[model samples]
Target: MAWALGANSNSPPFAPAIGANAISTMRAAFLIGIFAAAGALTQGGAISETVGADLIGGVTITPLAASTGLLVAASFMIFGVYSGYPVPAAFATTGALVGVGLSLGGDPAFGTYQRIGTFWLLVPPMSGGLAYVTATLLRREEVPETVGVPLLAAVVGAILANIRLGVIPHPERAQGSLAEAASFAVGRPLVAGVDVVAILATVVVAAVGFRYIRAKTQVSAEQGIRTFLLILGSVVAFSSGGSQVGLATGPLENLYSVELGLPSIILLGIGALGILAGAWMGAPRLLQATSREYAQLGARRSIAALVPGFIIAQVAIALGIPISFNNIIISGVIGGGLAAGSAGVSRRKIGVTLAFWVITLVMSIAIGFGLYRLLSTVLGIQ
Candidate 1:
């Protein structure tokens, strides 16, 4: 999402705060590493789990194959991020995984493919339309601040409350609602009378307590809207992490599951580390590529991009589909650009990026399939 990029973006004011020397560069690297690690733990882990479990149903990945796939995909992602190009990691990795898996005796899950393709195709137009509408509404003079802000807050609260949660790769084992989790922790059944009582108690406390405090502050409606947007952006970032890392680590599913002698958690940890490293060492360039190349963005524009990106990424994660962060962000950028008007963005740059996306997917699939076939023949694999 745009805010994810914006948050990591070195603002103009911060540019002069650090020098561009070896020591400074080293320090930057250090910070990048830390940020990347955090990114990996969240995004990488989610991505890996999706790739491993959903790519081919009813068959566990082999160690050699998984490692081969992961190494290849991750290398390309790092290359793109470092070279200041937005490599659609999800496109490349997912295509590669399908190529490799199909060549290795896996059947194509046509339904899954269709679902993923639908989301991928839908995002650009949907995001653009939503951004246009949101921008228009915000520009309106008659929309009341009190009503508008609370409505936004309710929307954000609904999204946060419904996000899937449980152990990775096991949707059925979900922790259920936040209220359910709390009730379960206290030895009460989620559907029992006790649970209902506890839920009411918590709701009363949160609503009354928050309302009392908010009334005391008497904050302006604009302030409330800003707060809601901020909260929404944060949730979106967390979801983005869950989705983007899959491209980084999905290829390694076999190694983590077999050779590494690990479960989903352990594999997720390893993938997370790789993502963290990538984010720290390689994330900034891609961030720059997006921020500078897409459109000139203020805070509101940035938030618009991020919200949709986050939503799409989380959806991909849930479906066990691989996706490109670059594409997702671009969809948002295009949406924001449309809202701003036709002349506000670079048509040439958009064309180039689109070309690259097409080429990347085609090339990655061809190479992956070819490599899998060659390897299988050389190894006498069945």
Candidate 2:
């Protein structure tokens, strides 16, 4: 989680110098390259596969179109990162793809649009509600660190265990339980991952419960709650990376893989680098704008804003839906603030942002359609 936050927070300060040279600039560039590369290795393959194979109606993107989309999206991100408010990379890129596809006279892929819309709509409320419930629960007298943190950790651990070890019907990959993984390393009878998972969960719960019972100090309780929030933040960030990277590159997948004969992996590598650049150059200003211009968000409030953004972003990535991180973050901030109190949320800001969203989508679509027609006409070919 810390790593994820660091990635998000540190990026805006380093990206510009990717084109420069200095000990610090070179180091920043190198780290950016490394993370982008690592992200490609970690997330690129699955994302590229889905984008290339899943996002169309038997369509093969033209090389001209793919390169055009990639260049267009990349240019937009750089512009946002350096000058304009950081528009969501997901929105810009996805919009470009849709634009290009429509330009080619392809019917709107409603199924894909529907899925993306649903996730975008669902993420903010769900994450905010969860964060609220978690926050409220920690405020109660009956929770303490040993009990709360460990219990939450155990739950997280169990999910990780199950997701990793459980056998899927299709993939045939061995999904070992966390407990099983731990036991296997020491040559123990493989604990049924589920049973071991349950036991671990119980122990964590008991520890937290006892600590709450023994609460002799207020500071201890506060420490425990912060730890829990930190853990939640971490979980949200890592999951987000997996889901959000696709927005940075999914549109060009068919162009790179099918049209240009580049490996999907290479396409992904390019996309990840683009995202890393977007984050480093663009995100901070947007973050500042949201943190201050949209609403005053202290750490507690910011957590409310960020948790939902992360959840929505991840869902977008998981399903191969392109969306703006800023859009998600801002929307989540609005919802979260509304949940806290309607007074603090600014109506004008919301109106302007929403209006921008509509304009961005419409303009991108129009431009794409117009450009396609112009190209086809000039070439005297379809």
Candidate 3:
């Protein structure tokens, strides 16, 4: 599961940077591995809880069921990665889980499904629309480079400031944002105004950073933009790790109840290793597919696409939602492609990709259900 997810999820975050030549494929893989592992260790709990514990009711995911579901989902993802079409790992995992759950006589958690479904429906349009607007504004001659770039940077910084990190005070219980951590340190109560303050502070810091980068004679504006793109990609990679790790580890959470049960941290560590391996070994092909096949994006458009991808990813993580990084990045790419004109985009490819997304979900569910029943009845296990 980890290997499959690592391959699928780790590539998109760094694909833009690789595509823009801001970073090499190997370096991107290394950074992705590091940041993703950090994210998994620190912030992978919430979504893991949701996937393992909240998706189905009246049944605990048995070891056999968990392994079977993960194996099926991973196999599908592996096939996609090698075939140069990135499958939605979340859909595959969710479908497989639901399939296995139903086989075990578990009822659907409709409320949870509603929430997940809503996010799945919203991500493409929302991220794509936001990217379109941002890309359009950045391309406008009226919007000066000095004004536009810093504004976008400020928005990113504000999001960063408010994003919850797992290494805060109550690491075992709840997460904490940078603002909340600062507030606690200074002996200030976490009032409603703290968010506003954090945003303002982050904006100032971003503006200063942008100004410094722009002022450097050694660094051209294009170089500065590339640097920013790399940063955005890295941040998004980290967020991907946090969000994607849960999908792999959630089913394994059931193992904790057995006699030789591993701890949550250990499971997370194992998942992190899988993600790292996937990033190193399997991410390059899909990265190329997304970065080149989907759209031709320059540094500016790449940055625009990644900004929304990062934001949407963080939002999903915060809500304990499992999302496809491929969907997010591709939507952003399409949005960026539209800014240049539809001539740069491939309509047929997009159509096929969308169809596969729907097919994978339904197929995984059916396969999982059938496979579980076959295994149980044939082996007389469970």
lDDT by candidate, in order shown: 0.55, 0.49, 0.83
**Model 2 lDDT vs. the true structure?**
0.49
* Model 2: number of backbone collisions: 10
For model 3, how big is the CA root-mean-square deviation?
A: 2.2
Candidate 3 structure quality by residue, lDDT tens digits, 137-214: 889999877667766766777787778876776434578877666655655544664555555556666666566545
Tell me the TM-score of each prediction against the true structure: 0.74, 0.68, 0.94
Clashes of each: 12, 10, 0
Model 1 lDDT per residue over 286-361, tens place? 5455656667654344445555665666667666666665676667766766676767677888888788778877
Q: What stretches of model 1 exceed 4 Å from their correct place?
A: 1-49, 57-60, 144-150, 167-177, 183-233, 258-261, 376-382
Task: Spell out the clash pairs found in candidate 2.
Answer: 1-234, 11-280, 12-280, 81-282, 146-208, 147-208, 165-175, 165-176, 166-175, 243-317
RMSD to the true structure for each prediction, in A, is: 6.5, 7.5, 2.2
| Range of the 10 consecutive residues with the lowest summed lDDT in candidate 1 | 11-20
